[model samples]
Target chain A: MKLMRLLCWIMVFCIDVHVKAEETHKEKCDFNRGNCVILAEDGRRVFRSDEILVMLAPRALLEIRNENTVQLVKGDFYIETEQPVKLQTPYAKIWCEGECKGLFSRTAVTLEVKSLDGNWRITRAGEKTVYVVPAGLQVSIGEVAENGQAQMEFPQSLPWVPTIKQWASLYPGKVSEFKPELEKFRQVWREAVEAVSVLHQTVATRAVASHEAEVEQARRQRLAQLREDQGLRNLFRDKNP
Target chain B: MPLILYMRLTSFLCFILVMMLGWMQLYSRAREIFNGTSEIKAEIGHLKSTTAHERIAMALEREQFLEFRQNVATLMPDVLKSKGLGEEGYPYRSLASSISRSEAELVRQTIAKTLFERAKDNFRQEKFPKAIHGFHQIIDHFGFTPYVADSYFLLAESHFKQNELEACTGVIQEMVELFPHHELTGFALVRLGRIYQVQNRNEEAIEIFKTVMRSFPQRDVAAQAKASLKGIDL
Candidate 1:
């Protein structure tokens, strides 16, 4: 019996650990209007995680599947990442890696991926073959074949890529050239995150403290009840004797 | 009899232990539910606070970008001259220079477009003050962009909505002076005429209406001007 009880407890512990391990980490929208639209008509919406940053052009729709995967419903996306990430569209799944900077766009009948600064591995939705796309190249997949796979075009050199100089000029004093200012912004972001974490910790501690107090009160009541029941049993025993 | 009593006592103790365990299980379930509720409430509170913070942060970013753009715009003329490029040569330059003039123009256009859209949204939401501010920002800092024409008209409209007739007239006159050939200039003239009529200056209103009718003949602005004239029995 003791062995069985011990096995049962061990199984419970293992299951608990397995459930925690299986819990998926979801990505949250960091910046955008409530419906994932840009705040301004011409502005882009930004979503960030620890590993990747995604910018959605106006009218683009993106859904987060997990920490490293996103589903692009339609429209254009500019993605930058320091880790491998997956972009899912109706036509294909694009796996990007190693400081990836890419543009992805999808429409009802087609999908396009451009690797501006990194590498991409694309597999059609129903196909087994994967195609590699290198930096400064683009791939377009259009129309499904008889075997239910989209036909991917040969990777070709991208027609145009925005230069670093152009990007810096577009957002002057905010990016590339403005290291100190960016650092200041990052500091603010860190402080805000720390403040929120502290607030969460305080709230959790208060809740746990209140729960402990309630449990202690209930335990005391149960002990009193048990004592009274014991006294009644003793009186009954004496009477019977 | 003694052995039977011992078994009875042992069974009773077993029953007590099971009952205690069941009670503990029930208490733990209740505690879980309580903790879950508290966690959900805390999450909701955190989300609300974070959303507000995000909005403020975004607003600050926009403000910073706008200030940067204004500073860049102010320095652009001198920079162009120093590089031996005409002021009108802005969009023809390459990135070889410290500041790419074409990129600067693109940035200006983007800021102007964004400001115009935001002002339009504010106008639709009936937030005249914020709308006026945005339109003014576009006109003051991004005057070279195409949105300037629309911004001028909207600024006048915002002032009109706020019943600031004098300010409305001033903006309309400025729009007409700056963009005499612009389609919105005709509209601005007609609006100015209407403002004159509202101030009971019928003669001046008629003169403005006649100007609109003469300059914008066979257009929507002429029709609007004619309607205003007929309203005053001209």
Candidate 2:
């Protein structure tokens, strides 16, 4: 009787664990059809979950892995999230946090991540070092090098960002609702650029002041050493006489 | 002692009688259950056999019907011509009514398709008048076929090729009213706008081009409209 009771408890525990595991990772979207198009009313194929909102561009293939994770198989995607979300591409993985909005594009040879309004942490596949990309900057990870290294490019200012008018023109039917989101993106991008510029200026000013101080201290030390040398020469001359 | 033996014997006889009665009742119940099961099994067998036979018969019937449709389809054009029956004539109508509706539709589609091909060939050869006649015939008599939209568009093109701007516009407007959602409507609108441009009606042309661009944003229709707009701007 004791053995049977123990077995029953073990089975119950296993069933509880299985149910918890299932609850933790449930698929939010299943878009396996070729090059998913926007058949919904919004003129964009959007997948919304508790953690992130993903908008796929024309002919883009994307799959939501779970609530907070998405895989970009090909083409472009724009993502908005208040919480942390993981974006997986063929060449790299990007972790976005803190009310972030970003555009991610992948192709056969490269994966490009543009931080439109918030910070993004990017790590190339098989690489350990994470590169933090601030808003208004973009990064591209190219095909792996022949020597088994990621060809990670340095972050730079976003070359071109689509305007609200252009996006509205592309999806004319949903212009009313789309315009406000794009306007907010523009405002956030402008603030981020200004913030980055001020930070750069402050760091430059501090570096210049520290360099000047170091130069002044070195000159004074040289002058003191010269005086001591002159005094020692005079004492030697007197003793010789 | 004898009276005790007699009592024991009578008790044994009564017990035997009860055992026999119980066995008889049990046997009757078993026989009833077995008979009921066999009856159900026989009914199931009959249903299975009938279904199999019906399926075979249906397959053979479908094959024979397909053969008959093929023969009728091959002979339909000659029969119509020999009977001196036009497509919309009462005699042809009566003949079409004699066949199944699907078969009649198939015949109409074949005739319309052949007419459309001939008209397209004429248009390609720059025989505008002949092409217009053929397209008009298709539109008038075989309008129910799927080639009507193509016929209308080609008819307008024939008019445009002959520099008959008014006729071209009239045909295009009619087509738009008839087939509002057809893809060719966008192309026809672009053509109409081009005619307007040729007539030096810039404002009207621009409006038509803008309409095309707004209505068919992702298609070649929009691209052509954009090109026309650029030309006007220049």
Interface RMSD of each: 19.9, 27.8
- On TM-score, the candidate that comes out on top is 2
Q: DockQ for all models, in order?
A: 0.00, 0.00
- The TM-scores of all predictions, comma-separated, are 0.30, 0.32
Candidate 2, residue B204: Cα displacement in angstroms equals 64
Top of the candidates by lDDT = 2
| Model 2 DockQ class | incorrect
On a 0 to 100 scale, what is the lDDT of residue B115 in model 1? 84
Tens-digit per-residue lDDT, A1-241, candidate 1: 4644554564444342335431133234543222232221245556666776776666566655455666676677777777767776656778875766667766756788866555688987447788877665668986443333456875655543242222233222344555663354345435544654575688889999999999999999999999999999999999998
lDDT of 1 by residue, B31-50 (tens): 87877975787889999868
**Model 1 chain A: lowest-lDDT 10 consecutive positions:** A32-41
lDDT of 2 by residue, A1-241 (tens): 4544554554444342333332232233543332222222223456665676776666565545455556666666777778777776545778876877777777755788877667888877546788898877777886443223346875666654453333343432366777676777676667666776786788879999999999999999999999999999999999998
